[model samples]
Structures are given as C-alpha cells and as structure tokens.
Target: MPGYGYVSEEQRGVVLLSDDAVIPQVINDRLVTAFASVTITNANVTGQEILPIHTADSQGPRGDESGWIQVVSARATCSEGIQIKIVLPVHFSIKLAPGQTYPVPLNLSIEGDNAPKSMRIHLDLADLGNTKRWTVSTGEYELERREWGSAYKITFLDYDHSVHYAMAFPPEGNCEQWPEKRCPVVLALHGAGVEASSSYWTESYRRQKNAWVLFPTGRTPWGYDWHGPSFWNIESALDALRLRPGVPDDLVNSVGVNRERLIYAGHSNGGQGAWWLLSHYPDRALAGLPAAGYVKIQFYIPYFMRIGDAYADPLLRGILESAISEHDIDLYASNMAGIPILARTGGSDDNVPPVHSRRLIRMVNEWSRKTTAANLSEIPNQGHWFAGVVDDDVMQSFVDTSLQNASTQGLSLPALPSAFSLSTLNPASSGSKGGIRILQLQVPFRLGTIRVHRQNDQWILNTTNVRRFGFVADDRQEGLQRWSVDGTNFDKPPVVSGKSYLKGEDGIWKVADDMLWISEERHFSTYGPAIHIFDQPFIIVIPSTITERTITYRKMAQHLATSWYLFGRGGTQIVRDVDVLDGIAAQYNMLVLGGPEDNMFTKKRQPGLESMVKFLPGGGFQIDKRVYVDQGTGILFLAPSPTRTRMGLFIAGTDADGLLRAAWTVPFRTGLQVPDYIVLGEEYGDPSTGWTAGDGAPFGGAGTKGAGGVLAAGYWSNHWDFDARCGYLK
Candidate 1:
C-alpha cells in the first residue's frame, strides 16, 4: 500500500496537507516529495490527528494513527461529514474556456458530505513539501578464490530485463600471478522475492576466485523497477562489470566468458528468466543449469506455478500482458537455435512448473533439429523449494571448465606462481583498490586471528602489526581525511589473537579483527587552503607491481577504444579519475591517467578538459570530474538530470540535491549520444547523490616520488579520502 497523509481532529472542517502528509502521486510509479502541513479555515472543533494504519494487523486501536500507513483506503479518516483538501505529488492542470476556477474532484472520501474516497482533487503548488525519502543500502560483497597467492581477479555479467542475476568471482584474484593470470567466471541468478542487492545469496557465490558470477534484478513495465527479463538489460550490465573504475583494463574484456565455456543457471522467477535469456541471447553460454524452475512457459500457469501464473497472477499478469502482448514468439525461437541448452528443473516445482520448461524446450526443438539437440535435466525429488542437488557439479565444473574441456570449452588464466606471501601492503591493493597486498608479518602468528579481504580482485592487507589505525586531516586539504597505519615498527614481532579470521578470504563477510578509526576530515581539496597549511598532501604511495604490466596497460587502452560499442548499462562519457588495474581493465582497452585536476569541475565537466578531448577520441584513458567515460567505445553513459518539473525549488542556487550530479542544467534527453573525447577521473562520493570534489582539490593519494605535498603527480585517488586497512593471515 502507498503512504498517504494524516488528518487532525482539531481541524475537523479543515484539511491538513502538511507534516508527514503522504500525498500519493497520480502518475504510475512516479514518487512525489511529501508535504509538511496544509491548513483549512472556518472548520469545526475537535483537534485530533490520525495517521496511516492497517486494520488487519490487530484490533481495538483500529482507527488509531499508530500504524505506519495504508495508502489504498480513501475513507480512512474519522469524521463522517468533514471537508478537506489533499495534496498529490501530481498537479492537475485544467483547460476550461478561459478564466474559470473549475472545481476539481479530489479523492477524499467522507460517507455522505461529498468527501468521496477516490476523486481527482485540484491543488495548488504550495501544498507540496512532504516527499518520503527512505534509506537504501547497496551493501558490498567480498570477492573470493580457492587458490592461495592468486592475485584475486574475476569478471561479472548480469542481465535483468531478460533474467535475474547475482554472481561473483572466486575469493582469489583473476589476474596473472607470477605464474598465471586471466581467471574464469560463473553466471549466477537470483530467485523470486529478492533483488540482486541481497547479500544473503550473493555472498554465498562471491567466495570463489576460480569462477565469477553475475547478478541482476527483474523489472516490470507497471512497477518502479524490474521483475525478470534478461538480454534487454544484460548486455549493458555485463559492460559495467567490465568497465567499473579500478579494474585491470586487460582483464575486463576477458570477462565475457568463452561462449563455449559457460553454464547458464537460475532459480525461481530467475529460473524462468534464465531460460529466457539463454533462449534469447544465443551467445551467452555453453550449458543451461536452472534449479527450481519449470521445463517450459506452459508450466507458468497459475494453477501450478509457485508464484502462480504471473500471466494469471493479478499483479504480474497485468505486467506480463502489457510487456509482451505485442512481442513475437519467433523472435525468441530464432535466437535459441545456435546454442546448446541444458535445462535443470524440479519435478514438483510450483513457482514454475517443470512442465512449462519441458514444453518450451519441446516447442523450440519441434521445428529444428539443431535446436532439438538441447538437453534437459530434472531433479527427481526436488520441488519448488530453492535447495537443489546440483550446486557442486554446476559450480565446480564452471570453475574447472578449462581443465575439464580444454579444447571446445576451455578458458585458462595466465600461468601463476605457487602460493606466495606479500612483502608489504604498500605495493598491493590491500590498502586500496589499485594496489596489491602488504608484507607478511614475521613470527608470533596468532591463532584464530582475523583478516580482512577486499571486494573484486584485491589483495588482503596484513593487520598483524602492532600499528593502530586512525584518520588524520591534512591541515593542508581542508575537509579531506586520510587513514594512517602505524604503531608497530618493522622490527616488532607480530601480536597474538584468538581465532583465524579472513575478511574476504574465508567468506564474503567476516568479522573485523581490529578496531578501525575515521576522522571527520574525509573529503579533501586538491589545492585547497586547508591542505596547504600542512606543507603538502603526504600520502603513502604504493609501488606499481602488477604482472603483465605493459601487456595489461595496453589491454586497458584497447578496452577504452571499443567501450562505447559495448551495449547495456546507463550513462556515457568518461569523467572520473580512478586507479588503473593493470592486468584487468587495461587488457580490454587503453587507459589514460589524466592529471589530478579532474575533481573540481562539479558543475560543468566538459569545460577546459583538453586531455579528455584528446583521449576520448583517441580511445585512451581520460579522467575528469564528468560522470561517464568511453562513449567512443561503449555505453558507460552518465544518466541525464531529472525532468525540469521535478527540479528543487529552493531559494539557494547550489541546493544541488538531485541524485547523480549537482548541475541544474541538463542536456535534454536524447538518443544515446557518444562523444569522441573523455573525462571522468573526479569520482562522486556517492553515485546516487552527485557529490564531487571542489576545483583544484587533490585526488588525495601518493604523489610523484619527489613531490612533497598531496598535489604532486603520481598520487591518485578516486574519491576524497584514503582507506587504511588491518588484517590477519594464516
């Protein structure tokens, strides 16, 4: 149910449209800011406030304002003959003859006095101010690998418009170790009810380095987001997994698993989504593996489906009908002819009948011998429940694809050296996304001690040292803060702890071993007066020790060259300064490291960025404060600003509260436009909120060898702060 407004008894004859007022928007799925209050004059007595409530939860206080909210009921108010004005997120414009105060029908229900529960009400612009804003978290997931000493690297691919996804690389790195590089990946899908953001399942899959998995959410035409569908959005999402800042460019393109070396899989709604994506995107995989899913679309009928037939289900049926009522079945059939499909279904599956999948497969194979060759596997005793019998075979085989089928379905990582420990964290990504792990502590190894591992293909930072962590403000960079790891000298022996704990190594999320400190000064300016006072920005620079360094960097250049051609995902134009993952993204395209001045252009990123102008078209790495990069190669687009009507009407011009960017002037919505130049080094504090660094603000990392302050060249940072890490090994 949607959230509506609260009414008070004192204003019986008057309507209160402010303060926690839940004015529902008229447009489907469109949200409106909530209002604070609305007053009505010449009203009756009785001053009482009523809030949103649910009559089904329990009794006595049925009409009490204690409950959260129930947006469906228009007659929820207490008074029977009271008149009130309700504000809506949508404004109704009337076009009468000329000068007329046309009475608009408002959906305010009062038993008999014209207080209709559902009417389109006429409202003024001033009656709005109560938009509900809730907190949403896109929690982080740790990458995993089974092998030791492996530079953790993994590529991810997701498709939601056609299928739901949630995948991760093994806990280990995917890059070339002293002996090897280039890791394998897995295709993971989600079930019904949960989105890709859910850590419960994603973490489970994130613990493997041998394979990488992909995750995506479903979308509905009538709903605000997605329900399930694949290829439609999968292409772009896969592109993002490869294009995200900080990944090794060379390794990014390698993530698109060898078509012949992949396994297709899914669960529940995603189960059907998987089948659809496989049938739709012929080049997506080598084998099909869906659990708790139907054998065909026929099984999706309500009487048998667990979620019931979405086509028959009130909510999804409407969505399904509206979304594909005009689509052609041949489109899906033609796409399925080239690939080998392996359908895994539960005999008793209810959400999706085993029969639906069975029928769909039969239908596809009916007309073509090549398509009919596809295989279908069913679990004997399994049903609609999520647990299945093939997790090991499917996952393990995906990891060992090269070894198992080295010829037709093999993908090998660069040869890696045997397990080895780092000499120091300074040169490794252990301290940041761009570097590697730190040195291993000597002696006094603690038992049951904990270690923290990073997400994606990052190394672990050893925290066994006696060093204490703290955040320090650069008297130089006014608001920026950087973490320092100190206390135990290189000569001190390691301390002892209770149990062995691995933050990213053992599991997706492990407990923190030691206390972490952060100072209020997190965001810093590049050339700000605050940092200037400290003499200069003093950041601990890590060594460039990535394997296949030149090869990797070159690959990065290539990835950048063709990034725009890559389909899927949102935003375009390169404009953020970030770390270069030598072997990863560098392998896919050429990456250019523009100077640090990219962080200051919060309003207009396109101005004065000569490097972006040169690098974008040249297909090289360019960095700046702009939101997107690689428009020349792929669709990493910077989403456009919100519609003008939704602009914040604040007295101050710099309110810059809109999500994504602070710029009020937006490029009118146009077809996906690609630019020949690049700029995107200045990273936003949060993508949802367009927080950027001030002009001339430093990137806040290690500067060139001799440069004293933070502004020196060679120092790098995507955002405003530095991350200090502590962890345990063995």
Candidate 2:
C-alpha cells in the first residue's frame, strides 16, 4: 500500500512517510485517531514564495537558524468499499539573519490507529547565495510567544460583515488602576495587503509600551485605504472591543471608546487612511501620524487615461470630478488646523513619491493660515520601510504629549474653541465637535463648513454651503453678549433648549430637538438625495415566487449583491420578498427587486409607491400624466420606505427582460447621468449612426416624452421630492 505525506512548497517543509510504512483503515463505524511528529533544519529556499512568506511580508525564517515548526494531527473513518481524504494544517515560523548558510536536519515519527511511518529529509542552504537573506512560509502561523497580543473577531448589528482586529495591552505597571485610570489608545491601520488576522502584523506593534494598540483589518486586505465602508469597519471594531469580556469595563465604555486620548497612525496605504480619517473626523483623534502616504487616489494614480477622461465631455468630467471631490484630502485640509499631525516619508522611496507629503503640508498651512504647518519628516537614504517609524523616540514623545493633555483636561468635553470650523458632507449625522452641531445639509456629499469667531463682545458666524446649524452654549462662560450672522449684527440671543439650539429666524432663540441634529449614528440610502449609502447596512429583496422567466431576476439580484459586497467588504444580505420580516424595513435599507406582479413586497407596497411612480395595470408604468409601455422599458427609482422614513430602491419593469436590462445598467453604467430616477428604452438600431444599440447604452441619456431613446431621467431634490424642472421628458 502506498503511504501519503504532507509537503509545503512555500514553507520548504515536508512530512514524508517511509516506503515500508503501514497505515490502518477504519472498520465499520469504529473511531480512530492519528498523530505525527516532525522536526526540520536549515533548508535551501530559492523561490519567490519563500522570501515573502507571511501575509504581512515582514517576518519569516532564516536558513542559518533552526526554524520553528509544529504539526497538527487528524483522523477519518471509511466504510466498506469507500475511501476518505484527511487534511491537516501545519504551522512554521522562521526568521533568518542576513547572508548565512547552514545544513538542516529533519526527524519524523507517526503513531495511533496506523502502522508506524517514518521519514527523514534535509534542506541545503548553500544554493541561495549571499544575495538572498531569509526564507519563510506563506499562510497563517501560530506565534511561538504570547507576549504580543490577542486576535478577535466581532459582528455589529448595523453591519452585515464581521470585523477582525488585534489588540495589544500595555504592560502591567503601565496600566492605570481601575475607575480612575484610562489608558491612551493607538489605532494603527495596516498597509495594503497586510492581513490583520495574522499574529505577525500585530506582534510588530508590541514594542509600543504604554498604550493599548489596536490593529483593525480595515474590513479587507484592500479597502480603499480605509475610506467609506472601511472607516465604518474601524468604528465597528472599536464597538466590539468595548463589549469584550477581556477588556476592562472602565477602559472601553458604552460609547465604545476612550475618546480623549485616541491617536491615529498608519504606514503606506494605512498612512493615507490616517490622513483621511484625521481630516474627515477631526473629533475622533487627538493627533495623527501618517508615514509614506498619498494625498488622494487621483494624485497617486492619475486618471487621465480613464474612459471618462478619454471622452473629454465637460459634463462627464464635471460629474466624475464632483463625485470624488469629497475624498480629496487637500480639499478638506483646512479642517486639520486644530489637530496635531506628524507626516513622514523616506527621501529615497520610489513607491510613493515624497512630494505628496510635502505638498499636503504646504496646502494645510496655506489653507489654515496658521504659522505652524503639519510637521513633515523625510528620512534620508531610506526606502519605503524604515526603522523607528512606529516606536521611535519622536513618536513616543508625541503620544506622551497628547496623553498629558488629555489627563489634564479630564473626561469633560472641551469648551468650544475660538475661531474653530466644522465641515461635513452628510450633516444629518456627521458628529459634534466643540459644542457645535450641523442640523441640515443643503448639498449632501458636498463640503459644508461653519466658521465661528468671537470678536470683542460679539460671536460672528461665517457659513458656506450650510443650510442650518446650532451650538450648545456653556451657560457658565460669559464672553459673547451678542451675535452676528454673516456680517449682519443681531441684538437678540440665539435660541436654546435642552443642551442644543437652532439659529432663530429673527436672530432670537428657538428650541431645538436632538433628532434634527447631525449625529455619528446617521444612516444613508442608495438612491438620489442620499448617495452615500456606504455608512449603513443594506438588504436586497427578491421575488418570493419565480417563473422560468423570472429566474433571470435572481441572477440580476446576485450581481448587485456581489458589487456591494466587493465595494463595502461584506455589508449586503439577500432574502426573498416573503422572508423579509415586518421590522426589517426599519433595520436596513431595502433594495426591492422585481415588478409588482412578480414580487410580493412590491405588489403589497404598490399603493404606497404611487406618489413616485405607478405601475399601471396590464403592462406599463405611469409617471405623472404620461404612460410608458415599451417592451424593453425599465424603471429604477427611490421612494420613502412604506414602514419608515428610511429609503427603498425599486428596480421594476413591465416584464423580466426590462428588469434584467435595467439591473445590468446599474452595475455597469449608472452614475450622475442616471441620477435619482431613470427609465431605459428599447434596444433598437440608431438610423443616424447605423449602429445596433440600446437606448441606455454607455449611460442612459436624459429622458423625453414620445421618444424611443431614454424615456426620462432626473434628480430628486434634497427633500426626496420630485424635481420637475431638473428632469427630462420628451
């Protein structure tokens, strides 16, 4: 009988069974167990996979030293005339010093439920010349020591995905006593391609002595440098840590954080994320350190050759540029004025040019008009990875300074800073900073800033793109006796009610409700007027009943669900319309697929959807006074949820074909051109161009009445109401 052995090409380790080995076969329902012992020595590792062995690409084994190796055992049962395959996982941790070679030894043994099997193999390190220094294995491995930290996984109610994070606690003496003690937190984001699930990455931060180091997976190996959904993943990770039994109750509380001493730091791609989070969420961190980071994706990788840029259409360019502007850190650089930042890059690094960091520092200084620019350090003659960036004296000093400030200030919220500014894209729940609250956002996804400066005895409020905002006054402080709105002086005091206030109509005070204020808990929808849906979890509802033709809708729903999963890294759930429970609408944003007749949820909610678009009986859709009955026509729009104020996206058509065509357009094209609502027309040949094309090909054109092309297209107002003036209907 032939014996089987386990071998790893990447780890350069193998477990071989001798030719004379005898293995046991299970008899009728009997239990069995197997065991193996293996030892390995220096091996000749000459492959690419052996060099960068771990996911983090930082630590591995060396040929000169004895590599750490361990074996896992397993067993399987087999019935008469049946064969089974059993697999076991092996772990290896190796780190070799530079330019060393040594002969390796191997010992092997096997026992239990099988005949004795033994094999020996030696690895030669001579083949790898002085040029190669180290060789390690690919895949996860258990750490030899437990001093680094512990790994954990958590799931949040608002997110469809589970998050993975690593936490490293401070040394015993470093930890403060309970009740009166609060340790500073360092949120260290990993670079692109580094898996936080592995102990290798978390172990690197163990050198930081006095702080609780948090390493979040950023939702995936690659997550847009922690933008959009990735940012939320970090927040959810923090929430999970607070509830963990291992964490002290006072260290991480109900709000999920020790907000005062929070510090953000990152390297490479994570470096970019540190900057992004710092600018967009200034209140979340005390100071930020970004190393070898880029300013924006466009700057890092120019988009001049993209399809949108190739067209060179002013309209198309405007739409594309406006959409991504919210993520451009330079545009929001001024918001970093009040916070401390230390940015660094290696002068010899070619991966990410050092100029990006220099330019950002200059922009922040110019925009804020502050004498002190962001501190920039360029290490000379160093490459992308430099020593002391994470645990250097300079970094330690910065953290110490920030922690001292927090300790002096205690836990109370700081008073509103003089000459401070607040900016946000989604005012509904952006968050409060320095006692100011943004109540409404006139232009969502566009920057809205409120600047306040106390001059002499009056408080002056300077606003841009702001619809409504308020301040929670500290009645104990008596500085400003009057107020000025946009250069207009008002003798009346601002309205105040229950810790919040709204700017009064006549410059007087009016009671304000917390519901109207923007909060960190704000939810977003996918359809128009609420384009930033990444912050909230969403579900897709397919028709419960299916026909031969309606089966295509299932495929369409899959495409959408997959796109969202890839984009957000697992925040999408799919369910049949019948299985969608009553309160689900309130819990998640709904994407209802299929026509009214085919989908139970759509059919039941049709009456409530009439205000937006009505699916008339017999085969057409009615919008206002016009009726669309084209065979290939499809309707995609957003409406208020029947059960709640949240939004629902509806993709319905006259039939299956229309629905498929519309669904395909969304995953491929739909952008600013498709706007809040769109009606796709039949596939036809364009006589003028002699081309067979769909009316919505490329991107759906503006809709018009009596036209076989795009039937209609328009945007909804901020209030989620129809905008007749902005829509097209021939």
Candidate 3:
C-alpha cells in the first residue's frame, strides 16, 4: 500500500521515486534552461530498477509492461527528444550494481518571468533524503522553428502510383544556388510506431549546414521493416525533392539534395532499417548512423515462433526459413565494409540489447580489418531512449566527415579492396562490392562466398556455392592482366567493358553469353515464398464475372491487401480482370486470387504456366503427372509473368474453403516460411478458433509430402523447373 497508488479501479501503479528541486534563478535572462543530474539510490530491495522510457511497437505493450501512467505535469508535455515521448512501456531486465547510486540526467527548461521558477521531478529509483542536485547552467539551446528549416510535403508517382513524403530545407534556406552550388541530404527514417504524419522526424534531427532532410513514411511505420518498398520511397522522395516532372523549376532547384553526399540515420526499428540500407545499398549512402538497432529475426528471438515450423519437415522448414534468411543483417555485412558507419546504443539497453550493435560492428570490422570502417558509441546509464542520442557531437562529427568526403561532380564510390571476399545470400537485394558481384548461386537458400586475392602476375578467385559472378574492367597502373577463377587460368580475359562467367552443370566455368547469364534462373528477385511478391509494386487481379464464389475471391483479395498494408505498409492496387487488360497490367506483377476458370488473367496464362504445374477445369490441379482432386486442397505457387520476365503469384484452391486455407500461408511478417510451392488442406482447421494443423503438434513432423496438412512443398530449380532433390510430392 505504501509503495503503490491507485488512480482508479483498473489503474493501479506506483511512483518509485519523487523529489522537488529548485531551478537556476532566471536572473537577467528572458529564458533559461539547464542540465541537471539527480543521483538516486536503487532501493527496489527485490532487484535492479528498470527505467522503461520508450516502447517499440505502435500496437500495445509487449511482455510484462503496461500502458503509460496518467500524470499531470509540464515535463510530460515536452517531446524535446527521442527520450521522453511516453508510449507503451517495456521493462528491460538490466541489472545495476547493488547499493550504488545512479545519475539520471534531466533537461529542465524555463521561459519568461511568469514561467514556473521551480518544479518537482519523478523517476524510477528510490527517493534519497540527502542528495546533491548537480546542475550545469547554460543558455537556452532551443531555437525558433524557422532556424531549424521549414518542413514541407512532396508527392511523386512510383511506377504511376502516387506516393508522398516530408522534406525540409537547411537553415540557409532553399537551395537558391542549384546547379551553381548544391547541398547534402540526410534521409532520416522514423522508428516503429512513429507515424510519418508526425513532425518529430523533420524537427528531431539537428540542422546541418547547407543540408536537406527527407523523411519517407516507408508506406507505414513498419513497412517491410524498411527493406523492400522502402527503398523506392527514399528514391522517389529524393527525385521529387531534387527534380520533379510537373513542379516549377524554381522550387525544384530550391533544394538541391546531392545524391553523392547522402547520409542515413534512424533509431530503434528505424535503426535496423538504416542497417538494412547500409548493407544492401552501401553505395547510396556517404555514411550511416544507426542508434539502438537489432541484428536479425533469428537473433532477436532464439526460438522460432511460427506454428508451421513445429509441424514442417526438416527440408521444408529449411526452404521456408531461407526466404527469411535473406533479411539476415549479419550475412550481408561484407557489403558495408567500405562505408563509414557509426553505430550508437545505450550501454544498459536491454530492449534491443547493445550486443546487436556489437555483433554487427564486429562483423563489419572483420570484413574490412584494415580500414575498420565501423565504430560503436555506447552511452553509459541510458536505456533504449535517450536525449541527444543521434544529435551528439560525435555523431555530428561522423556526418560532417562523410560530407567532406563527397566530390563535386558525381558520386565517389569506394575503391575496390585489392584483396577482399564478397559474401551474399540473395544477389538480387545485394549490391556489388569491390567491383565484384554475384549474379546467381549454385543452390538457392545457401550462403555464397567469393574470395579474391591479388597475386604478383594475376588475380586469384575462388567461389563456394556460386553459379555465376561478374566483374567490371577498370584502369590501373599495371593495366588489365591475367586472371584465374576456380583453378581455371585465363590470359587477358576478353572483358573490354565487363563480363559475367557462369559455372555450367558440368562444373566448368565459361564466359556467360547475353542469352544465358541471369535470364532463366530462379533468382531471389523473381522466385520466392509468398512474401517475395510484395518486393515491388503488384496488382491484385480478381474475377470479372460474378458467381457464388465471387465474394470469397474479393474477400481473399481484400485480405491480402489489408495484410500488406498492416505488415509491409504496401500500397497494393486491386483491379478487376475486365477493367484492366494484359498489355497495361503486364508491367506490374499480378497476384491472381482465383483459379483459371474464374479468373481470366489466370486462364490466359495457364498454358504458359503448364511447364511446371497445370490448373484443371474445377479446383483440382496437376503437378508432375499427379492429379490432386481433393476438395479441400489449396495450391499456392509462383509462375513466370506474362512478360516472361516478372513474377506472377497464384493463390488458388480446389474450392472456396480451400482458398481460405491457402491464404493462411501468406507470411505477412517474419518467422514463417512458405516454399516456392505450398499445398494447404483442411487439416489446419478453423482459423477463428486456433491452429490445429499437424494434429496440434508443433515440434517435429513426419515428411514433407504428407507432414501436418502440407500435401506437398518444395522450391523450384535454378531454371524454374521441378527439381527432384528440392521438392516433395504426394
């Protein structure tokens, strides 16, 4: 009773610590503010005290935390930095030393003669009767909004679809000196739950001299976790800011966002998003600052949470999880070996532990040991959220250093390491490093490493799990010389510009011709589980003619659309088959909801897709001479688009019920894997109640073909053909 207080029947809480402190007398100044450090004793008696200053999810409290406490105070109204925006809370179990006092830094502000002279403050630690209030008096650092730059909105069409983002010019005002003089740009990404509509992103960052800040909503707060479509968001925003099609030339030139001097900075999930771009598109950023970022899905949670994994076969599980494995940040660290990275984290942060930052920095240094491109900044006595985390002097120095490195004319791409290895899991999402790139892998869902060493007379290269690799011809003092790859020697290889070489099925490396390079392979860009289709702009094609199953088709389409918005923040366009024709829709990936008989688009492409699987007149489909006529069977697979270049996803079933079951496999988030082809049955039971699939067991399964309710599941071969070794059929 003494420790806790009751605000209401449902709101029972406790104020761990409270104290009254006098502010510096507003002597001869109109406004005053100071940094006060209050030392408090850890008197929890039970264990270490937790200061949960912020929550990651926009939804609700996770784990053991609860809603924010309703306290009437001016301190609560202040959203000065990332630290005090009170939302859902998560208690990080970080243990501080026993019987020790900790310093809790507080920023106090006062204005005008009428402002409150002194105020009381509360914290998580126990109250100390005798304590000194350490204060550092200084001028009021807060400035007028105009000095911080003006935040404005800009819209652009991404592949004919409308998209908008927030942009701000520097304190020097708009780039009035466009082509004559340009300014740098900072692409600031917001954390999870921080809506793009808020002014926080634009105003939160410290204004850089002659630099513009662009904030793309990333569709929604959690769009692709800032991966897939988020890339397009940033590019479109930059394009609109620098040069737009319809906008007046004066406004366009007013903000010259230099492409060569681009910098990326974010916090929390956004911090992870920064890492994603830093690793995947290293050439795009001059430098990156990721504060409180997590490593990857598996590292975030050791035990898999997907119910399917408990019931999936070992091989099937591998195929499914491989789809997620592409997003693993650690595997792609080699690409960031050349970029300057300053990773920041709270020294005592347990929410997204500091280890994530440490692990990534370690990997980056290991790949670029000579340069040591990445460094870590761990602020002591801080949690997940802290004031001045991204705007600190050290961070400003890193960014300023990167800006100084930019050239006037064009981008200054990092020089290729004389001898460095390039590692990649998905070549499509990964950019070229050290002038070397992997076009495709010998096997899908496996790590591919290409090691290069510069010897005296020639360059040596070795590859593991690599099918094809490419290199650019560059001018050096020694000029083009001999080359050796996988023990095959070549004297003056015929690569005037650049060339790609592939290892044929015979295990011999040969120069890849224009027609045989990356065209006919199941690259990660073209072939993947259910989630891969949303990597780009996709249209949902539903049936034109109305029938008893028409509502079901529409409902399924709507469900897919809503899921994308909720999970990936995707703006998926849904169109009726009759309204849009093949010629116009061919440019976009099509997500056909119903079977060929009901959906005209599917019917038109049935013959083309027959090479792998054939859809029958009714709901039954044929795979490799086997016909599954089960009324409850649902089939979801990937097929070549009408253009024979893009991808088309088919989510169909033998009947209405089966269609609903198939939609269950659409992975909106991580931890769930769906192979290139997956068959769902009624064995999953009703979704409203819960999952009863695999007889309600989630540990281990029998086999791929008949395990759980999965009738069949497997990945397509490099040529997009049925591979006996990679697939299972009933």
**Tens digit per residue, CA lDDT, model 2, 105-145:** 11222232232222222222211121222223212111122
Ranking of all candidate structures by their TM-score, best first: 3, 2, 1
Candidate 2, after superposition: displacement of residue 5 in Å? 38
What is the lDDT for 186 in model 1? 50
Off-target runs (Cα >4 Å) in candidate 2 are: 1-158, 161-163, 169-180, 203-210, 244-257, 309-313, 411-417, 456-458, 471-484, 487-534, 561-573, 578-582, 603-636, 643-645, 653-715, 724-730
Candidate 3 residue-wise lDDT, 604-682, digit = tens:
7788778678888767998777787787678888886755456777888888877877776666675565777877766
lDDT of 1 by residue, 105-221 (tens): 223212222322222222221111132212111111111222222222222222211111222343244433211333333555666556454556555443444444656443211
Candidate 3, lDDT over the whole model: 0.61
Best candidate, lDDT: 3
State TM-scores per candidate: 0.31, 0.65, 0.71
